[model samples]
Target: MPARARLADENVDFMSLMSEANRRRVLGKSTPVVYPAGTLLFREGDPARVILIESGLVRVFRTVPDGRQATVAFLRTREILGASLIVSDPPWVCAQIVIDSTITDLDVKTLRNVASTHIQVMTAVATQLAALVRNAHRLVALRSLGNITQRLAYDLLERACQSQLEMGRLDAMVTQEGLAASIGSSREVVSRAMKGLRAAGIIKTTPGVVRVVDPVRLSDTVRAFLRPT
Candidate 1:
């Protein structure tokens, strides 16, 4: 069996999910707050609250049974953390500020009120929630079932797909340490996987960037990471 990348639509973020007018409307009803690095915005099992990142980086993670935190995803400017909260049942994930950031809190009650008044907003939130769930399920599978190499391949492919192009290549702006954390491996292990990828003409790397020169091959590589259950 071959590994394949998920559909592009499965990668929806908040800015991508909402229209300009809809975004403005939501933001208008939200309160922006500045948070410093090391701030834990929310913790696992905590009630969900929609937080829109206006600037800086946020690391979303979940605590495993061993009490170690496993990286879930990173949220950046214009991305919404706790988007799954829009649905009745949200996953238990904690969000921490990786860099000093400004976030807009779209109070759940306020969002509900606005959503009730606007069908388009409700539709967009529903769509975003559905995609978040699908992506979450895939992430869980990759973390639990994939090997180090497969996990590394999938991480690079996912980040590349979300990044902008440079010289016809996709640059995933993440450090090896970040990759290690995201993939639940040591930095050395991730470095070895990266070396293999580079040797195979799958990627090129700089200090804090991984450029995918062959996305088709990377995509095919990721397909080998997961199988239908």
Candidate 2:
């Protein structure tokens, strides 16, 4: 299969590893919160708390020694943040809402307690953590080595594939500014990259939206960068 097709077909619902009853048991203890864009869900050094994204997007970032915030991840619906906190300390990271969001703040104490007695919950947590690690590594590679165009292509294609899974659409509801942040570049650089992708017939962009016109070609752009050169 093409790399882009595989990414879209990949099952990202890590929580589905849990039994239905166990899934309900863990989530039933959570409190849903609706946050508008730009809201900080949590900040660096805040006490650990698990949040389940029911819908919308979140940008997880941390400040570096240079006082610049480095984006760690862009989390979407059906993903869990702070799941690692069940076994470790609160990380030096902050989660901010990038879009209007509905999230469930899981009762951490309950989650920990449930995990102690439930094998399914433990399995689910393991799956989620593994996914997080894989995403973190992929992000690092793209940012460290990819040029603006390749980075933007990967970011847009990633979100587009995610949207396809979640909403049955191949559109990423992101602005150029968001793309820049995701790829650790300036908006002007991202704009140029967007134009490149557009010219290649890989994507179509409008205000606050980028629809994938040729995901295979977009994935090729990203995949080419990842290949040993």
Top-TM-score structure, candidate number: 2
Q: Least lDDT summed over 10 consecutive residues: which range in candidate 2?
A: 3-12
Cα deviation at 197, candidate 1, in Å, is 8.9
lDDT of 1 by residue, 16-129 (tens): 556788777777756789997657788777777888788876666777787565556655566676655665666688777755789988877767766888887777677666
User: TM-score for every candidate vs. truth?
Assistant: 0.56, 0.65
Tell me, by lDDT, which candidate is best: 2
Prediction RMSDs, each to the true structure = 9.3, 8.3
Distance from true location, Cα of 96 in model 2, Å = 0.7
Task: Give all candidates' CA lDDT scores.
Answer: 0.69, 0.73
User: Residue-wise lDDT of candidate 2 within 1-229, one digit each (tens)?
Assistant: 6433333223246466678888888887567889975577787888778888888777677866775665676676787889888767656788877567898988888888889899878767776776566667766788668888878877786677546544766799999989888878899988887888888888898999999877656756765554432
